[model samples]
Target chain A: MFERLLFEAPDFFTYYNVIFLLEAAARTLGMTLIGCTVGFIAGLLIAVLRQSVNPWTLPLRVIAIAYVETFRRIPFLVIIFIVLYAIQPLMENASLLTIATIAICLVSTAFLSEIVRAGLESVPKQQIEGARTLNFGAARTLWYVVLPQAWRVILPPAIAFAVMFIKDTSLASHIGVVELTFSGKMFVNRGFSPLLGFGAVLVLYFLLSYPLSRLGTYLEKRLDPSRRS
Target chain B: MTHLDVRDLACSYGSEKILKGVTLSAEKGEVVSLIGPSGSGKSTLLRALVGLTLPSAGEVRVAGKAVDYSSRKSVRELRSQLAIVFQQYNLFQNMTVMRNVTIAPITIKKRPKAEVEALAAELLARVGMEAKHDAYPEELSGGQQQRVAIARALALQPEILLLDEVTSALDPERVNEVLDTIRRLTDEGITMLLVSHEMSFVREVSTRVVMMDDGKVVETGTPSQIFDSPTHERTRDFVGMILKH
Candidate 1:
């Protein structure tokens, strides 16, 4: 195995094609930003909606639950394929990249909603009463009091999820989004060197992800007042 | 006029009752202190008055206005007339002291920003927390936090104030600072109904003293009468036990 892998003397220097690699990395990062931003906001709405109790809001709650459960159960590959092909014809001049980004965003949103909902539940019950007696009507109470505290608990998990969602952008290749993984594949085909090209891609993924993971840990500790000395 | 009047109030959790047939009243400028052993339904009574816990069969009148808690609009109107402080202080952990006191007036009441901010500053000053307006709740001691909670409640300028075991969570030394602040409120004439375990503070602050047990009011009297004279066997025993140490 070792002989076959290292037998040929190859020019590893030519792989420094800065323009191609930089362009691919930029596209990958851009899609990740779009996916996480849209996904977090949409997911937060769905999570809050799922907890609604009013008669008029009951249908919305049911729809939120169904959306979260359905997206979570189905694989992302299947979701991307469905959006790229099945839903493609219904669109008016939408690009393949747009379809793939939507698929990734939808799946990430389902998982994000569950994380956010748990954070909301972890807030103490006394706070609701505290707001009530202060005459901060129900809607204002939630917007001003409950949600702000919930954000402290929700942020760490959401940051952790954003790191995972950035990785999941690789799966967008099924719909031909030309993200990081697709760039690696193109590099390998053109250079006839799989290990060097793909290995660089793997290292790039780590470089992009490690800082965010560290940031998430640092913030989780900072946000928790009890943990600080 | 009666500032707070509760009639035959009853509340239960699941099949077990927490408050049963409890009725009480306080006139304007009165400070009524509820004192008894733990699990004596003192706090339950205060919570029910604020509609935090719905009464199974009862009515609450705040300053001559009947409160129908079953209707959302009525509950909102009734709440505007009252404010409560809890044993845990229950300050909004995410906000600064200034925001904690000013948020309701600005957001819910839609009062002018300058007006609400001025009132908040005044209330915080009254509670001796003006210097810490920029501080978060976690930065303060338990006693300090409770003081901020009181200021927050007072900022609403409610007709009636409910304080549920406000001193129970503090250290022995810390309790007096909070009691001093409550003493100042007594002079402000906000018509307070408070639950407390400190016998001396209750005797000093309250216009009327109520002893409760098993979710029922066992006795009600002036502080001097309740403390110096024994009206009932239960009241005597409770007052004696708490005053001993």
Candidate 2:
């Protein structure tokens, strides 16, 4: 296997094959980034909506709770197929990548909203009451007081979820989205050694997630209330 | 008209009533202290006044304008005229002392930044926290945080200040520092409604003292009237118990 890997090293490093792998790696990163970005924003909205005490928001709060609770319990692969068929009927020409990305967004939003909710709740109730007494509206209170305190709690878990999804995006390969893992399968099917093909894929995954985790650590330190002046 | 008028105000947490038809009023520049045992609804009264805890029923009039808790504009109007200092300080942990003091005025009220900052500086100085503007809440001791909380409330330029057990959470030695700050405010002409366990401070600073028990006001009178010459049986018992310790 070592000799075969060594022999294929030159051919595997060919411009076209390298581009193919790089494009696949980009897709994996793109899906994770786009999914988690959409998820975090939507999750934050859902979390905030759920926390509101207004009578009019009750319906929205119920829908948000049902969404997070339901999607979180469903498997990622199952969601992919569900979305694949669901979207195909609505938009007959929808790409596999789009279907897979939608599934990732749905799942990440569910998980991240719970994380954001817990973060928002960690801020003492007195802090919010303090804001209210000072004449702060709901949006101002959140922006000025709650979100600042919540970021410390929300960042660590949010980043962890994003890192986890980097690997989870490989599951998108089942729907023929041609992300990192799918590229490895393609290389192996083309008669390249399995170890070499999969090994490159493994390195690319690590490369994507390591920087993200490091960014998370940096944010956690920067946002620490005790450390800030 | 009373500076702050709470008429038959009632509040509840679920089925448990906290403030049951409690009526109270504070005239302009008057220091009215709510003295009672825990769960007497003193804090809840203050919370309801500021719209923090919605009053299940009753009317709160600030400067002759009735507050409607169900209306956002009315609550906002009420809050703009009143500010509260909590027992735990509740300083924005994420901000510097300066930011906590100036945030509401600068952001919510859209007051000019320079003017608000200048007032904040003066308020912090008055509270003896001038040197700690850059410090965070976690960096301050309990008394210092309470002082900063006072400064934060004052920076709002509120017509009335509600202090809900502001010094109860402090250490014995730290209590005096906060009391001294309130002492300075009593003569500053800001109407204040405070809930405190510090008997001497309450007596010394209050223009009027109200004794409450079981979600009702037992009596309202001057410090000397309530403390030296008791009126109601409940007031006498409460005063007797507190003075004993």
Specify the highest-DockQ model's number: 2
lDDT of 2 by residue, A71-180 (tens): 99988988988999999999888899988999999999999999999999988898888888888778988998899888888998899899999999999998899999
Which pairs in model 1 have colliding backbones?
A: none
CAPRI class assigned to model 2: high
Badly placed stretches (over 4 Å) of model 2 are: A214-229
- CA error at residue B59 for candidate 2, angstroms: 2.4
- Estimate, for each residue in A94-211, the C-alpha lDDT of model 1 and write its tens digit: 8878888788788888988998899888778888778888876667877988898888788899999889877888888656777778878887777536776677678788888889
Provide DockQ values for all models, in the order shown.
0.73, 0.82
| Residue pairs with backbone overlap in model 2 | none
Question: Per-residue lDDT for A65 in model 2?
Answer: 92
| TM-scores, chain A, per candidate | 0.89, 0.95
lDDT per residue (tens digit) for residues B15-79 in model 1: 98999888899999999999888998888888878888888987788878888977888888888
Provide the TM-score for each candidate, comma-separated: 0.90, 0.95
